[model samples]
Target: MKLLQIDSSITAPNSVSRVITAAVVERLRQTHPGLQVIERDIIGAALDHITPVNFPSSHPISALAGDAPEFAAGRATSDAILDEFLAADIVVIGAPMYNFGVPSQLKAWIDRVIVPGKTFSYGPEGVKGLIPGKRVIIAISRGNLYGSDQPTAALEHVETYLRSVFSFVGITNLQFIVAEGVQLGPDARQAALDKALQETSVLKAA
Candidate 1:
């Protein structure tokens, strides 16, 4: 089995979510020794958004003319990114919430991987996910305690967006370990991290 560890945290060694995610990966490695792990840090090489400059091919159906060379240049990068994502048997995402949402790096990676006709198909019956039978785990860290029910719980757009988009690509078996209240204090941070670690333990057992 192959495991893709995608780290979207801007913080290198100090990232709380990254540390927890590494622990999760290590625990899984203890059980699945044969698992090959692939690591991708979006902070190092940010994904280019699909736009008029990057997604010229997508404009082929449009009446207006588009830049052929510019579109052709981005094809290789797009294809490589898609291939890496599709080849992974399991995907582990380390997402540290920025301003109550996902970091820009993570969103950029998502934009590249969840391409039409590659990750999903559009038919008369609507949309069908092409990449199915994959399990995904998202390690999320937040400053404040923002959950389904919390007084200061801000909008959980990061986790929700990930779930929705990955589900659209047929990844229904998604799990999340959120370490909230990290910025509250040292005690609160440790407590939240402990909870997240415990959840990771459960996930590993499964």
Candidate 2:
């Protein structure tokens, strides 16, 4: 299986989300000895925001390609990102909630992957999902405790937003390992990390 691991956290060795993400990959490698892993670090690469990925390069009807050089360049980057997403069997992402939402770098990566015809298409019935078989696992870290059970759960947008994007593309198999309340105290942070690491280690074999 080809696994794509995306890490967005700027903080490296000390990041809880990165720690969990590594553990998840380790678990997958343990289960499947031949797993091929591809790592994309969003912040590290300094990915740009998306513009136009819907336009085809070889359209027979128009000279749009010659008219827009910017679109051509933008499409190249988008295509590379989309290609990776399409090729992966399992996707592992490090998502750190910043101000109740996903980091801008991660959002930028998400934008580049959502092509109109490639990932999804609008039809008479509804929006159709083109890619539906990949499994997505997210390692999410939050400064405050905000999950389905926390007081500020409603304000949490990182996981919810990612779910919507992946679901829209028909990839609904999602799992999350969360380390919450990291900023509360050192003990709370360590405890959350421990729990998330445990969860990552016990990830189901399939």
Candidate 3:
């Protein structure tokens, strides 16, 4: 089984999402022996925002002969990112809420994967997702509470956005392990982390 582990946290060792994701991956590895794992740290290798030069419409027909060096490089990077996502049977994402949304680095990665003809398509039936049957697990951390009953629930965008995007690409087997209110206090942080870690321990294996 192929597993793609994507980390988008800028906090590294101090990141709650990162710690939860690591525990989840380790659990999966234990359950699925010899699983092939590919790790990508978006914060470590930041991707540029999509531009006209690297956008799919601007891809050159042959060898990118007429394309600028930077443009060609950008296109290649985008293609590589998309290819990795396509090749994975399972994907585990470490996403922390940033200003009530996902980090720009993760969004940049999403831009490459959610291609029109590659991952999805539009038809008379409306829209159709090309990629299906892949399992996705997201580890999410939030500084404040945003549960359905919370006053800030409407401001919760990370999980909502991720669900929409993944479902759009035909991935319905989605799981989320969330740690919220980590910044509330030391006690609250540890409690949240403990709960999230417990969830990771019971994750279904590939």
* Top candidate by TM-score: 3
lDDT digits (tens) for residues 1-206 of candidate 2: 89999999988878889998999999999998899999998888877764333333322222343546556665566567878898999999999998899989998888766667778888999999888988999999999988788778899998889889999999978888889999999999999999999898889865
lDDT of 3 by residue, 86-200 (tens): 8999899999999999999999899888887888988999989988889999999999999999999999999999999999999989999999999999999999999999999
Misplaced by over 4 Å in model 2 are 53-73
Taken over the whole model, the C-alpha lDDT of each candidate is: 0.81, 0.84, 0.90
In model 1, which runs have C-alpha deviations exceeding 4 angstroms? 52-73
lDDT comparison, 2 vs 3, better candidate: 3
In model 1, what lDDT does residue 197 have?
Answer: 92
Ranking by lDDT: 3, 2, 1
How do all the candidates rank in terms of TM-score, highest first?
A: 3, 2, 1
Question: Which candidate tops lDDT?
Answer: 3
TM-score of 3: 0.94
lDDT of 1 by residue, 1-206 (tens): 98999998998877889988898898788878798999888888777766545542333321143656656677566667667788988888999999878998788778777767778888999999988888898999998878878875557678888889999998888888899889999999999999999888766634
Error of 2 at 30 (Å): 0.7
Model 2: lowest-lDDT 10 consecutive positions: 54-63
